[model samples]
Target chain A: MTTTLTASKEQSCQTLLASGHTACTGCGEALAAKLVLGAAGSNVIVTDATGCLEVFTTRFPQSSWEVPFIHSLFENSAAVASGIEAALKSLGRQNEAKVIAQGGDGGTADIGLQALSGMLERGHDILYVCYDNEAYMNTGVQRSGLTPFDCMTTTSPYGEFSWGNKHNKKDMPGIAAAHNIPYVATASVSFPKDIENKVKKALSITGPKYLQIHSPCPLGWRSNPQLTITVARLAVQTGLYPIFEMENGKITKVRKVSTPKTPVEEYLKIQGRFAHLFKSPDGNEEIRKIQEIADRNIEKYGLA
Target chain B: MRLDLGAIAKAGTSKANQTCGWRNFKPIFHQEKCVGCGLCKIYCPEGCVTMVEKKKYTVDYTYCKGCGICAEECSSSDIEMVVEEK
Candidate 1:
């Protein structure tokens, strides 16, 4: 964490993701993108998938990115990044520059999963960052593969007949690690240092790397814009979102929860998307189920 | 505020677009308790908080969306969210 302080100090003077784009007031993806680009620095080339980040940051005539960036459709950021990496290698500039492929959860876990898997299997020198806000936020909040169970969205609406999204979030980090890449980690925007350190570490490695960042969406989550970081922190503390690193398909580091760990309710109550889970008997049952999911993650990942 | 049609837009054009009017609460930095750790500056989504002196910092209200991250992440609890008047 001390290193994070130094990184922040260094980043403050030379920000790569300049603000002023049209992201929401407390957009988690925007914050995560800033931290990612800041950590990646100016020497890297960025390949973005068509998602909220691409839509908001590069709005036609105006662009927020200061580095060489390419917006390659909705599902080819990883492939595009691989191509860039190959090009850089052929040009004898691979060591001097890094390649980063970025996308939202929908782009990463759903549409772009094939390209991402191909890139990982190929062992390309690229860092694939998935800013997971849980759903297809840019396409008016449709439920994506990464959308958590019992969470509400436009497509996965909670009503008399339904309980929001039916399926659990896809284990993207596990999928990435299955490729046996050098680095794979889950981070939250609430913990900037962890994200920075992971990005730095991933870049230091040669082969494909995956970093899925748990970024909350205030608009989609129906949470107060000001409480973005609070909600993100609660997600990590509650064991719902485990922040850990894997090397060669083995767990190398885990960010343990603080003493007297926060409960899942603390994380769920803040978002309107999870409001239905706190309403009635069935809702309470759903909450219990969600809590069980958290408990299972804690047990599985040894988050305690 | 003028747009240059041919030239690429400035990296931080949001600075010229005042967003404080949309905020219901604003963060006030109390200088006495400040520790100049720059955590607020780093976590600020708008990048509105700027270091004035070594130990002093100020928020540029024009672009700040008043997300309160600065207040929340402030190590010394120096930044407080005050209700903004209409």
Candidate 2:
């Protein structure tokens, strides 16, 4: 596959998310943000929350944001973005800039959910993207609400009697769709062109839009940095993560997986959080459950 | 198909508040020449690891914390560490 990042993307992509901003090598969140911003172009104002992406991309007096970006509080990015969009519209400057709110899973699925909900409900001609690494990675890998069941986190240690996490990931796209936004989609960093195209499509539309992008974390997920895109591809192939688009509160299309259902094990067996599954049979049931979830998702979204 | 301006107009009135977070860990296991002996279990801190009825084991990351202890105690070079994709 030829990634061949565009010159516009390469030139504008942050070589420095900040001079000394700290991010683990192969941080998917950072890459996803850079790509999305590059696609959105400089004619946009971004409201960001305090999360792994924000903390590592912008520090005092140093920032990789070549566009107009603001670091709002953790739970208020959507509200801030809404205000920015409103102000731009009222001032007849809407054409001067587009509005975007960004955050990681913690900020998007848990802490900032209310503000995000409000922003979507109000239909403020803005685009909100969630770069989901699936944990409170910035805060020492604590388990967040979006964490999958039995996945290990700092808070959820794999023990004899207890699994790491205990709940399914929240259906964020479903929630967004309920708002009846004109456009809602799921994307991943591995497919930059798809994400860029979706962003362009959203920009052309005249109402609120939502994009949930999968970003594979290296340190938190315990994988090789170079394999970020590979893991992303595996996720899509395994049906563990489905890429699709929803318009006007309905599913319109889904990205097809190139191969027959890849084993969830192929994807799971490569990560440290699931090492226990190889240790004993007890983990098999959970694996089956996860596979079932993915299979159901594939069936629902027609990813097969 | 014509773009639905009514849907666009309705999106403005629905009023949604929002926030987001992430919590997922990827697990890695090395399967080399070895007996299917499950010692990683007695040591797992999160109880996320377990064996299948007739096959290999599985990791329940909903509970696994990505600690390296299991890899550390592997009698065989059967389990390695892998980072989870976001």
User: By summed lDDT, which 10 consecutive residues of candidate 2 chain A come out lowest?
Assistant: A11-20
Q: Please give each candidate's TM-score.
A: 0.92, 0.74
Put down candidate 1 lDDT per residue, A233-271, tens digits, no spaces. 888888899899999989999987655867788899999
lDDT string, candidate 2, A1-304, tens digits: 2233332333233221222224454566766776676568767888888898776655443455556677759999999999999999999999998898998889999999999999998989999999899899988888887777678888888888777788888899898888888999999876766777888888889888999999888677877664666677788888888999999988888887656568899888877876777678888998998899888888889987
Candidate 1 C-alpha lDDT tens digits along B23-74: 8889998888887787877788766677888778898887778888788778
| Chain B TM-score, all predictions listed | 0.82, 0.58
Give me the runs in candidate 1 sitting further than 4 Å from their true place: A1-8, B1-21, B83-86
Q: Model 2, residue B34: displacement in angstroms? A: 41
Q: Which candidate comes out best when scored by DockQ?
A: 1
Worst 10 residues of 1 chain A by lDDT: A1-10
Going through the candidates in the order shown, the clash numbers are 0, 95
Each model's C-alpha lDDT?
0.85, 0.71
lDDT of 1 at A275: 92
